[model samples]
Target: MSRKHQWRGMMGDVAEKCGTTVAIALMEKLGGAHFVVPKTYTNRGPMAKLGRELAEPFIAEYAGQVVDIPSKLATKRPPPESRFQEVEALIDKNYTAAQVAAELGISQAYVFKIRKAAGAPKISSKVDKRQKSLFD
Candidate 1:
């Protein structure tokens, strides 16, 4: 199904379970708005539950009135000053880049970006030496 139809169906389900007002509010608020769902929703069970409860009521009241979902409300968090430090710490603790990415709910590429930004030595690979290898 199309995303719009899917959204409508989900909203219908929410309304059926929660109430029409709550569902309508949620649909209107989320419709055409770009936001990320935070890892806290996955990490802290109680906070996530509470967040869901808090979301419905406000969603109902604000709905189409809101233009942009604020960072405080949405999952798009502020940039961390210690992102590099966090990555370094994980590496020092013998965590693989993939492990760090899973832990941080980010991608391996993002971990590499953080590693590069920290001025760490690049990981040399056969790909890097390919032309030289071919000539030799």
Candidate 2:
């Protein structure tokens, strides 16, 4: 005895019924044009050097944003010894300092200090994992 084999084609009719176009589908995929938005910064590369040169050092009366706000309140204090581990976990999870601060119920600035103290790795401002508003 012998058997015949056959293959069915794509259900383009179903796709059509779903009302999705080829261009629309591809644009919504990862690395697609629909979702990703490129960042726009004021200065970059060589301009950053020039910017630094023109930047002024913090002054006593510069009117800082968090004046008198204790940096210690940035994140939860588990213990002095566990600071590194805690900070490491947050970084590994790619959470923003603000996210860590919020999770640990503290301030974003303090979470930044923990990161500095641990020295886990470099984090990019543009690619902060937690996707938080900088002003927050």
Candidate 3:
């Protein structure tokens, strides 16, 4: 299904009435919680951050109502198999854990964990071969 269709109920209404950009901002800022829309607009707080153009209509419709915002992860996470495949592909390219983490927007530790799970070869550390030994 299309990403647009995934938004349902109040979220879908917000997307339809306030534009997708505003809806997305709201989701990013207030998802996974019950947000109380103020009866009146003010110069501060979440509504103010959303700006008058978008916030006004929302307040008009949902004021005095506690609206439940969906979690960002509900829409954003890919399937685990796909994620594993992506990590495996990066490993196959000989990317280091740090590089894989940065590229995938995950932690380096997680990349290492994935490497361990996949039984991939250990990433070699960079050490200058010409460095003089302390004992020498």
The global C-alpha lDDT for each of the candidates, from Candidate 1 onward, is 0.51, 0.38, 0.71
User: How do the residues 1-136 of candidate 1 rate in per-residue lDDT, one tens digit apiece?
Assistant: 2123323334434445556544444444454344443433343422233356655454444344423322222223333334888877777666778999999987787688777866775544213322466556
Cα lDDT of model 3 by residue, 1-136, tens digit: 1245757557777777666776777778777667788999998877877788878877887888888786666466543344667887776677777888999998797667666666655666433345588988
TM-score of 3: 0.46
Per-residue alpha-carbon lDDT of candidate 2 for residues 31-115, written as tens digits (9 for 90 to 100) = 1121111122125422132232221221111213221211122122343335657755876787767777888875676566666
Relative to the unseen true structure, what is the Cα RMSD of model 2?
A: 24.4
List candidate 3 stretches off by more than 4 Å: 1-4, 77-136
Which residue pairs show collisions in model 1? none
lDDT of 3 at 96: 71
Q: Number of backbone collisions per candidate, in order?
A: 0, 2, 0
Instruction: Pick the winner on lDDT between candidates 1 and 3.
Output: 3
Report the number of the highest-TM-score candidate.
3
Tell me the deviation in Å of residue 27 in model 3: 0.8
What is the Å distance of residue 117 in model 3 from its true position? 32
Alpha-carbon TM-score of each model against the true structure? 0.33, 0.32, 0.46
The 10-residue segment of model 2 with minimum total lDDT is: 1-10
Off by over 4 Å in 1: 1-81, 123-136
